[model samples]
Target: MQAEIGTPEAVGLSSERLERIVPWMRGYVEAGKLPGLSVTVARRGQVVFSRSAGLRDLARGLPMDDDTIVRIYSMTKPLTSVAILMLYEEGRFQLDDPITRFLPEFRNMRVLVGGSRAKPETVPAERDITFRDLLTHTSGLTYGFMDATLVDRMYREEGVDFQTAETSLADVVAKAAGLPLLAQPGAEWNYSIATDVLGHLVAVISGQPFDAFLRERIIRPLGMVDTDFHVPPEKIARFASNYALGEGGRLTLIDDAREGRYAKPRSVPSGGGGLVSTASDYARFCRFMLGGGALDGVRLLGRKTVALMTANHLRGDLADMGQPRFSESSYSGIGFGLGVSVMLDPAKAQILGTPGEVAWGGAASTAFWIDPAEDLFVILLTQLMPSSTWPIRRELRVLTYAALIE
Candidate 1:
């Protein structure tokens, strides 16, 4: 139902090799590694392999379908990045401009220099954080769940969570500003709440609520009808139950589709990791990225802008940028682009991927990558918490590229 479900051979993929995906998926389901999942592989502009396997709701006897909606988490970053870039294209602000021109909550931001969580030593940032810093995740912002440092603890203590409706985005930014940054702006490439800050920047710059802006501009324009911050009551039936890999290798129910936070509207949507989407719906978004920021004749971004966004903006690979242990990709050869991770060298990363392929994944293990070199893209959707629970993304990469016969 997404693009055209054509034969794999037509797109330089082996039909017989593509069949290997089903058994591999069933292996995970049968082994209790995944409850249900779906994969969409498209070449050029047409889908050559698309399949949904296993059960979406284990208790409800619901099988994973092409339209099943699941929390896409951080995959929401690219959309938010594109939204802000649209404002950039209007000459609203320069990439190097200090973000103090924006909300100004971060005007007095400090960098952590020494001391402990109880009483940390800090120094005023030598330079103001920029829009480019936020886009590249070099803004020194940190997420609460990283749970790795004092800044992260401060975020949690301040209740600066973004994936909830309880706190406003404005309030979260204000709280984040009160804490010391994990690093100096543009000094380190920490995976952080930078995108959430970008979401607030979108609201401030666009004079529109973040969710409203996204729906009116990117989502609706790209035909991602099922992509949103929350699942409406009418569409709750298609919302998959979220699970956590529990002790003894059991699937633990975390969020039920019948009643979850996503069932209600989000007051402050997280640009980093707060959106639900389907395989087909997400495929539409991927098509937009592959089409140079247009889908079906509607262009939201120019070709040069799209190229700039996908190109690696970091000085070098992520490892050289002082990336932390927690990340959506390997640090060795992967590089950070504007809002996505750009593969720099598969040999150095020790992964099977082409250089320049752009990707990002969610906390629930959902992932998508667009490979301009291959004229290909792949989307994987599942509802599992803490993406580190499995090596599926890496394995899926191997399974996928190995099937390309051309």
Candidate 2:
């Protein structure tokens, strides 16, 4: 269902201030810093501000719009986390349960003790990796591209990247199991393939393929029509081009919408970063979270489960774990929850945000945050690679909050 569009004043925000987002976003497109962008803001279930700028396809001159589908990347994690919690409510698995119960390969795991990538020394893991470890990213798993540690090198050697189309989720997990973990289970926060494992677990426990489970259980229920693991033939025209900053700060096409791998389905559906969605479709998902796991009378999770998922599960600041190489959010006042980052202290974060705000961004410069405090949520969609390339999320937050008059 489409959200009801309303004036900012209706939602207790200044219409004049909300209009500033247009020029601010247009400046990036006009300067050729971004190919295109779309922003959506909703308050109390009404869409207060929604606008798009620039082109979805530069060559074709297709402008970005509400329906333009883009790769959401790591934003897929929150959905995956929600799916896990849905199954948890059904008595599928416990948060602290060892993942080895279903995926035995994770049992008797080894951690990198002390050695080089060529011949890494290892020791047995202190304990089996649990669902909490996977959810909180403390499972010792590491993304191959995020760091250059020995385990990360091993991940590279084992073909542990997420872009592959041939390898299945099971195949990737098996390969990852053979490689030594970067740290012991629950040792420290390491953004890794843990969510992919959770995706595989979703398949294992639900007895359905990961994509099938997500589609039938979550996507369809939420009415996220344009969201899926791959863009179909008819929807190809609506898919946005993925780009990266090139030499001398020019937008370079990195993935073509029509010819990219996302144009077709893959065996391995990356739960951590492998879904495509439009601004409206994703806003629906965010609205579901904001509604306490329900939207438009369709409840995907219990309200208590939603509360549990958004709560800060981490003991202290995420920065204390280690310097985060991927996420742009300040770790000082941030703590991780099931699949998204939870704001713990806005003062220490030095960002215009509230505690209990749950959010996450994608690798392709897309971000969404749910502010339960203000009954607000914002979605910023774009096609730039390495979300860190620009401080758009932080700036968007400032722009969004400054517009609130009430």
Candidate 3:
């Protein structure tokens, strides 16, 4: 394996941590586990290790560069969550306010118990799905395809179209209103398009398009040049090709022919899964949050708001749906905070990390975690699907934690 630090991007990181991360990156690529990756590590607002490895596109033999843009799917959620908090900090709305206050269709939402018809089982929600619930995933929203409950199946049959390339967020939410909710408001922890709902709310409250609001408030201020819901035609060559395993164990390039805002600008801005960002740019964002919401004099939120976003909001019995099988080497019983995953029980988590570490990932093999206790954040970005089931993410986290001298 080969390793080298290009140059010191900044200071304040232990040389030991930089030395440790280099080999893990080399080993991961040498083993042909990841096609290409961009890794960035930071401590107290300074970058320690920033490097790129492997080929961005295996077919065309495109070498991975520092400027490779990647799809950060659900990682966009934290940004959306921060946008919501910004509005909260502005006193636009309270966390406990019913979603119907902005989106009237959400008022008389019902839960689906049995069949095609809205069954005999029905009850008024004890409380409205709050802004806090949107952050915590306790709002009882289902992703439609992940869980195999009756409602999930119905979601697949009816809701899949709205998530497709042509459908807009408004179309998706309107369809969602027609379907029965998985549970009462703020009841169980179900991962769904709640952030998309927040995107709509951002439109309502800010009097601007969701994407426009994000661009004005967050993206432009942070100088995130390449971060956006769509990749412009001029920048298409910079976008990495997403890949997945196919029959006979051959690595195949996944089809990305789906349309709308991802490849080209569209009016429907998705807060849930619509963002393309580069490593350095996203690192700036993480640094802002890790530094308690202010970066380079641009404060998107207050320090206390940053704390509130990362706090453990899961009540007694209602937490994550179940412990997801991250990989053979790791098990996570983590719960959702506002927009990130909070490591609830380190002992039960069976991974290498401190408790209170806030983390989440994108669908395209990109993941990151910020450990406030250690004042450290690590980001790994790649363009591959089905990334959660792989062991590399856990191993990377384990090695990162092991490198800490303190």
Q: Candidate 3 regions off by >4 Å?
A: 1-23, 26-32, 116-124, 160-165, 256-261, 316-333
Error of 1 at 371 (Å): 0.3
Ranking by lDDT: 2, 1, 3
**lDDT for each residue of candidate 2 in 1-406, tens digit (9 for 90 to 100):** 7788888999899989989999999999999999999999999889999999999999889999989999999999999999888999999889999999999988888999887766789999999999999999999899888756878878887899766838688989999988888888887888888898999999999999998999999999999999999999999999999999999999989899999899988778999999999999998998999989999999999999999999998878798776555564668899999999999998899889889999999989899999999999999999998888989999999999999888
Q: What count of clashes does model 3 give?
A: 0
Candidate 1 local distance difference test against the native: 0.90
TM-score per candidate, in order? 0.98, 0.98, 0.89
> Can you write out model 3's per-residue Cα lDDT over 252-282, one digit (the tens) per residue?
7784423323676755677887888988778
Regions of candidate 2 where Cα sits further than 4 Å from its true position: none
Question: Which pairs of residues have clashing backbones in candidate 1?
Answer: none
lDDT of 3 at 56: 76
lDDT of 3: 0.73
